[model samples]
Target: MPTPIKMPALSPTMEEGTLARWLIKEGDTVSSGDIMAEIETDKATMEFEAVDEGTVLKIEVPDGTEGVKVGTVIALLGAEGEDAGTVDAAPAAAAAPESSESAQPAASEPPEPTPASAPTVAPAKAASSAGTRTIASPLARRIAEKKGVDLASVKGSGPNGRIVKADVEGAQSGSAVPRREAAGPATGQAAAAPAGPATLPDFGIPHEDEKLSNVRKVIARRLTESKQTVPHYYLTIDVRLDPLLKLRAELNAALEAQGVKLSVNDLLIKALAKALIQVPRCNVSFGGDVLRSFSRADISVAVAAPSGLITPIIVDAGSKSISTIATEMKELAGKAREGKLQPHEYQGGTASLSNLGMYGIKQFEAVINPPQGMIMAVGAGDKRPHVVDDALAIATVMSATGSFDHRAIDGADGAELMQAFKALVEAPLGLVA
Candidate 1:
């Protein structure tokens, strides 16, 4: 008997996926739990594992083909002694053509039925001037061809209307030349008008533009939507951290023999969780129809990867010890950089933290991740003077900015939440039970 391997749902929001590579080719033997292929979702490229042990009979979807819906049978597995190629399954689409130049030319490829669903484009024609036998600018010709209008029908209004770029485009595209309005209050000198458009920069370079991976495409679409549709506001506060720094050195010294090394980020995470408990309003999401609050606080911490950025959470962070949080953070960061994080490792957080202290950023704000009420951006700690007891004194300070959903929380509530966070960080001992 032959078993089918369907595409699995790799993440909660994943719909269709890209078959990035085939780890096991047809006729190869596979065991349960062995990796079979790499699938790229809208966020990251991940592996697909074999669920049943057998010989690979046939592969359906080929590498680089995307929009493969979940549960679509991607491969066939046959019995140990069975001939694999004859197993009946849905007719596999032809594998994507290999783009490498060393491979055989496309003309030598096997015949494939052209899918009726594929998009088609009509050919374009170059536009020429009416009476004169001169060629128009490329931009004008393209605009004219798309409009299906004759360039001869347009009247040039320049020195010769000279059939310049704008004249041709305006005539063919049916763009109206603005009627000169009555001169404004500044009309006395020469009726000076605003400068018209000049040739723009050639921002695009001639280079290979590889199609975006499924994860990157989705991330771009979602982040654009969040930025455009969601109303966001930011508030920043400077926290004095001299006391916290002293506590960190003392704690690390006391725990050195126990092999526990805690970082400033770990201490910040603990403080953030405790602050969320005190200001429960900040640990919430605003559904357009309802306000949702969480009993347990989950804080998402940002980690930079080679491909892009990813945020992994520390669940119930307030209840965990500094050492435990530090250890788990190290592991999570490692997995994130390697692009091997599980879906659970990156999803579902009530808030997010983006720290750039390692890069020496003095201050910055982050966009809020959707469904999360707040995102905190932390900057590097630096020495600065502050007035204390009516006298100026030097102190270590770190600036933190919180970007919140205006719909989910108000300015006063946001301020209160930040104040609480500042207190928790400034008084380091308050974080521990």
Candidate 2:
């Protein structure tokens, strides 16, 4: 008997992923906990592990396949003493239902097919056929359920007349079946317009059209939604960095023997965290009917990766030393670049920080990453003439802009947060304290 290996939902929000690579091929014997495949989700590429030990009997979906829906059978595992080749030849349509009692291990029976995978027959059709079942893939069944479509009325296009994801989606679009609104606070939002034809007008121009990667697509969609939905207001403040720069040099020199060098961004992260603690009103998230205010400052620091920009969080950063923040940030940034960050590493934060000082950008306002109440955008610290005790003086200064979600944070609270952050950065000792 053979067991099916279905595509797993790796992340909470992941509906589908690209089967980036397969570590085991057909006929390869595997043990539980072995790395089976690499799945590329919208956020990161993660290794999928084998849960049940068996010989790889068949690979239903090939490697490098994109948009593989979760719960789709990607492979089959033959039980001990079962011939891998014979297991591969078994009809998938019959294997699912007939092997229910015999194939599965006694300790752990296979999960029953949900409404999405079960053959759904309309009342009239069920009456006509008496006991015939509708055959659909699990993904198809879920989509059918979401769309409120009668599976019996829809035609199956999969092998042996089984309904798949495409079949359910196509059926919904073509039929006049009313769709049930998805249940959530974010429901009722209109679907984004489908991309127009890829054909561009050719005026005898040479160009390359590279496709958007999953990461880029997710970034674009999420950012667009953020800007469109979140009510954003910006507050900018200029902070003289002379004191912070002097202290940073002194601290780095002392910590050099300990193999720790702190960057200005690291200090900024600490400052932001402290500022959040000082002004607790800013460390909050909008939750539709309720506001979520956190006592700890979990800062999400933006890092640019090959795929796209990702924010890896520093949990409870306000309580951590500057050296610890630097070390953790370096490791998290590395993992982010390698696309190996787990969900917990980059998922939530009380606030966000985006620093473009290294690029020498003067100043720029960043969009808030919801449901975070605010984001601090730091610009380059360059030598500039400024007022010092009512006299013009040259000093290293940088502009910091705090983008606040006006819905959650009022203008006065946002300004207070910005002032607190500026004061900490300029004072130089508060960050360490």
Candidate 3:
């Protein structure tokens, strides 16, 4: 009897996902912990590892198949000394073809999605890592086609020399044959818009539609729900940044040989966590009948990724030194961009910090990510007139806004947290102490 390979839940909240790619095919021998496929969960594109090792008997879901529910048997594995081709087709409903050859996905690939699975984002090279197919990431293929680059000639850079989006962007044209463009949808993707039928009438504008990745769709749905259901209020404060900047320079000089660098956001994350400790009332989540207060701050830092904005948490940020926070933040951010972030790397935070200072965004209020009581939005620090020791002088200042769930945190408590955050940033040394 062959064992069925069901789609595992990649996250605590994932119910279904797009089977982004199948790294292994039928007749391939796999072992425990082998990465068999990439699944696009609601949060990120994560690798699905094989737990039961055996020869790949079948692949029920072709690459790029969407909306596959969790626990769906995606493939089957044959025990040692078992023949893969003769495995029962009845298990996965012709998971293979009717012919003698089994688990051939190209035959099932259709024009509907315009090679919907065309991108092997982490592309397999001319001879794939699996030694069976040429793979390019879906995005890479789309861009390659649009840019007149041929996949056959471009070398891949991903694992096993897989071609990724970045690789495709810089590759020289591999063909002058003028490959025909695969037409389906436009390439426009929005983090805030749900990808589906156009909800409004078009004014005869020439545009092609692009399918929304799972991450974009989830962002659109969740943010909409948050705004509609959660009662929100905003509190803004002006904080001087000169002390923080000065301290950061001193710390970086001291820690340079250690290769550790601190950003304003890292210090701010620590300040927010400490402030949450000082005003515990603000560190809470709202339940309809109960308010859940937290003892520690797992601050979710908002990072802008290729897909959308994701908040990877700094767990127990209050207890970690600023250097540690900077190190962890760098690691988490890299994972977030690569779409390899695990569920625990991003889920369940008591609060969030969204910094746009680098982009020179003067000030903006961020919408609160639900269940989390509040989000601190930090803007750019510019020289501004300020009162110091009862006299007005120019100071490096930035505006910070806290968006709180009125249901979970009182306005006064939110104010106190803001005050504490401001004091910590202004004094600066308290952060290291």
Measured with C-alpha atoms, the lDDT of residue 43 in candidate 1 is 65
Model 2: how far residue 313 lies from native, Å: 0.4
TM-score, each model?
A: 0.72, 0.77, 0.76
Give the per-residue lDDT digits (tens) of candidate 2, residues 180-240: 2322236674323223123355577787766576788788777877887799999999999
List CA RMSD, all candidates: 15.0, 9.3, 11.2
TM-score: model 3 vs. ground truth:
0.76
Winning model by TM-score = 2
List residue ranges in candidate 3 displaced over 4 A: 89-195
Task: For candidate 2, report its TM-score.
Answer: 0.77
lDDT of 3: 0.79
User: Least lDDT summed over 10 consecutive residues: which range in candidate 3?
Assistant: 105-114
Off by over 4 Å in 1: 88-210
TM-score preference between candidates 1 and 3, better one: 3
